[model samples]
Target: MRIVVLGAGESGSGAAVLAKVKGFEVFVSDMSAIKDKYKELLAKYDISWEENQHTKELILNADEVIKSPGIPNTAPIIRELEELGTPIISEIEFAGRYTNATMVCITGSNGKTTTTSLIYHIFQSAGLNVGLAGNIGRSLALQVAEENHDYYVIELSSFQLDNMYNFRANIAVLMNITPDHLDRYDHNMQNYVDAKFRITQNQTPEDAFIFWNDDPIIKRELDKHGIQAHLYPFAAMKEQGAIAYVEDNEVVINEPIAFNMEQEKLALTGTHNLYNSLAAGLSANLAGITKEDIRKALSDFKGVEHRLEKVARVRGIEFINDSKATNVNSCWYALQSMPTKTVLIVGGTDKGNDYTEIADLVREKCRGLVFLGVDNSKLHTFFDSFGLPIVDVKSMKDAVAEAYKMAEKGDTVLLSPCCASFDLFKNYEDRGNQFKEYVRKL
Candidate 1:
């Protein structure tokens, strides 16, 4: 079968390689320039690809198409493919069909990477033959083709979940649903919520569906669309028969067996990470991993880069790189974890962000603000009433130094850009690395 892969980025290139390995006639098309590494991979596999354009005739004639999660449904090429009645599937869906690995997929507006990484660490520490795939580690398709593992832990985004029809996880985790990537969903919260719910679409009674019971969005959706998988709800507040709950400062996971851990002993801090720890711990227990294994993984697992990553402690002023906090909710979580007053370095590509959600947090925790983006009008307008010291910086170094100057001993300089990082840096990782480098130099 002729398979056309759209967007020659990480996901598309990986899909093309897997399709070729499966003896499918694979062709990759990207409107933008393909990266050198991906181009080399396609050439090594003898996969035909077109970079500056998408040949409509060639792509439309394919038996199936694998779309990168980054490509929106509104893209003209995608819409055209849809109009032709062609089957367009995500890389995850394509890879799922080729492997019988038990899939443990996690998705959320925030904390997904941390939770997914934590779960993978737990499974790996337990000596399970597991591969970390999806949005973080390696390409799922690439890993499936090259390194065969018995289990796969995937971090699914709503975008990746959109085109997947038959892809079902044996164990599914929905960390919490929040208003994110709504710009791609026609700015409709329900549309995004529905897309997140797709993670559990094909789950059966034998499958387990774990989610946050405290999030109103997830709770409302759960009430609206009944889940088929055995429900395991994790919560911070009062919960009865909740598969996972915090009581007396201990996380209780009552499942096939019962397990408890002191919440304060978890390496990851904050109420948000506590919930994350609980969700991951519950999954580990359900998967038959020992409580000791879970505890070791939870305590030793360092944390995902760019999310509350400590850079340096220069003269007692703590510098935290939370460049992955791309939304107000993520920034709120970061701020909530701050033990000291913060000189917040925030700003980047605005994704229709609602700063109002974090206004009170900023007012309380932030001593000053360093806006690091091209335009700071929205931030200025929103924060005018707070009368906090606000400055603008065009680069990450300036943002860090400016914040450092403003922060006193025992103050925290947090680079939790509550917006996307495309305005000033290549991406969040680049932004975070730069921040760390500058902090180390201080």
Candidate 2:
């Protein structure tokens, strides 16, 4: 079979490697320059690849196409492939075909990285042979091709779930659905919601589906979808028959195996993290992890980078790097966790963000706002009535400096953009790293 992999990034390169290992004639193509590491991997495997342009003839002749999640369905090439009746799938979908491992897949607009990492940590601590893949770790296809394990904890995005058809998770976790990445979904909330629901599409009675029961969107949609997996609903409020819930300041898991832990004992704080901890604990219990192991993992997990990560304190001002907070909902979580007044560094590629979600939090928690992006007009217009000091900056260093100037003793400087990082940084990680580097110089 002829397989064409698009984008030549981590996912695309990994898919090409897996396709080659499965005896498929593989070709990798990327319209942008392929990274040096990926190019070396393709060369080591003797796979043919091209960068900076796509040869339509080569791509059109493929028997199958594995697309990177970053590629939109509206791309001309994708539309052409669709019109030609060629099957295009995500790398996850392609990798699932070759692995019989138990898949623990997670999807949501927020907290996916934290939840995926927490679950993987729990399983690893329990001595389970697990591969951490998807959005948080190495590519799923790469792991399946080389270091195949008995289980995989995968963090999926809506884009990935869109192309997945026959792939089903042994354990599927839907954290919550918020308005996110709507541009790719034709500005339709239901479309994005439907895409997230795909995580449980091919499950059976033996599989388990864990989700946030309190999210009105999930609650309203759950009854409409005919999911075959056993439902495990988690919430901050105690429900009569919930699989997981908070009771008397303790988090309780009632299904598969009963376990309870003081809410304060969880390493992650804030209401958002409470939901994350509950979901991770429920997943661990469903996977047969011991209650003792789950408690230990939940308490000791260091949390994902760039999400409420504390940087060094400079002259008593706390600095937090929440560069992963790329949406208003994520920013709201960050702000909600602030114990002190904050000098918020925000702004980036807008992504059609609705600032109203975080408006109350901003007005209450933030003493000032430092805008960091190519343009700050939208932010200025939205925050004009906040009556707080606002500064506009074009670089991470400038933003950090402005935040420090606005911050005082007992104040916190938080870098939670509430927008995509493409305007000023290569990605969220880069934005976060630079924030730390600049904070250290203070």
Candidate 3:
């Protein structure tokens, strides 16, 4: 069968390679230029591919299509495929069909990257033969084609979850749902919520569903959706039906294995991280990792790069790089963790964010604001009247310099954009690296 993969980025190229290895007639098409590295890999695999255009005549003949998560169904090519009733699936879904590896899938609006990394770290420390895939590590399709592992820990975004139908996770983790990527869902909150809920689809009673019990969004959604998986709810405080909870200054778990650790001993700090630790601990425990292994790994595991990564402190001022905070909710968490007044650098490609969510936090914690993006009118409209020291900067260099000038001793210079970095930089990693590089020079 002819399997056409759309958007030959990391996931799409990996999917194309996997399809080729499986003896399918594989083709890759990208509207934009395919990276040189990927082009070489595709050619090495002897896979037929195209770039700079999506030829309908070639794409229309596909028996199935593997779509990159970045490509929306609203794209003309995808719409045409839909009109033809052609089956389209995500790389994760297509890879799932070929592997029976135990899947520990994670999804949430915020904290997923850190949590996913934490879980993988714990598993690795325990000496389990595992592979980290999905949004963070290597592509799941690529790993499935090349590597052999007993387990795979994947970070699933709502976009990846959208096209997934029959793929089942042995242990599915829904960290917490929040308003994210609403633009792709026609600006309807429920549509986005439904897309996230897809992570739990096809899960049976034998499977495990872990989530934050305190998240009102997750709670409300749970009431509406009937999840077949054995629910393992986690929370900050002990709830009625919670399996993992903090009590007496300790993280405790009641089911799937009784485990407890001093909360203060966790390597990751702050309330959000406590929740992350609990979720990671529960997931690791459920994966049959010993308590000693889980405890050691949880305390020793370092954090994710772009999410709340700390930069150098020059001239008694701390600079934090939270470039992974692409939404208002994520910024709220970053600001909440600040122990001192912050000169917050924010703005990029706005995703219909409601700044009101972090308005109070900004007022309380931020000494000043530096808007960094090509456009800043929306940020100005919401924050201009707040009477805080605000600066509009189209470039990261100006944003950092202005923030450093505005900061005083014991104050923080935080680069939490709260919007995508596509406007100025390549991606979040580039945005974060630039912030670090510029801050280092100060």
Residue range 158-239, candidate 1, lDDT tens digits? 9999999999899999998777787899998889999999999888999999999888888778867677899998888657
The pairs that clash in candidate 1 are: none
The whole-model lDDT of each prediction reads 0.90, 0.93, 0.92
The C-alpha stretches of model 1 lying farther than 4 A from their native spots are none
Q: What would the TM-scores of all predictions be?
A: 0.97, 0.99, 0.99
lDDT of 3 by residue, 19-109 (tens): 9999999999999999999999899999888999999999999999999999988999999999999999999999999998999999999
**Cα-based lDDT at residue 172, candidate 3:** 88
> For every model in order, what is the number of clashing pairs?
0, 0, 0
- Ten-residue stretch with the least lDDT total in model 2: 234-243
- Please state the error at residue 211 of candidate 2 in Å: 0.7
- Candidate 1 Cα deviation (angstroms), residue 328: 0.7
Find the candidate with the highest lDDT and give its number.
2
Superposed on all Cα atoms, the candidates' RMSDs to the truth, in angstroms, are 1.3, 0.9, 0.8
Can you rank all candidates by lDDT, best first?
Answer: 2, 3, 1
Model 3 accuracy (lDDT, Cα): 0.92
